[model samples]
Target: MVCVANTTGRAVRMPRPGGPGGRLLLAGHTGEDPAPEGPDGTVAIAPHSCSWWAI
Candidate 1:
């Protein structure tokens, strides 16, 4: 697998739980998944530390 070296910060917004006026925003590396979905989000293996949260 090929990985792009990125240092700039980025954010991805997705529909949050519930209905209107709800949204989920997460910041991290942007990559693709070549496998099926699991119980959690896409699995990512990074050389550095990472985290995920919901607000």
Candidate 2:
């Protein structure tokens, strides 16, 4: 799993192991923890809590 942020005006691409069939999960400023199950281990990126980004 990979994570990318476009805070800047640049385009970024994350590589996946299983190619096109791979699944990507994006989590925003939510305070919930992600489930720990997937075909491979799940990948979590920028897992910020709602309170953290409020500031």
- The candidate scoring highest on TM-score is 2
TM-score of each: 0.20, 0.25
Residue 24 CA displacement from its true place in model 1, Å:
7.7
Clashing pairs in 1: none
Report every candidate's CA lDDT. 0.30, 0.36
What is the lDDT for 43 in model 1? 34
Stretches of candidate 1 off by over 4 Å are: 1-25, 28-42
Model 2 accuracy (lDDT, Cα): 0.36
By lDDT, the best candidate is 2
Q: Which stretches of candidate 2 lie over 4 Å from their true place?
A: 9-18, 30-55
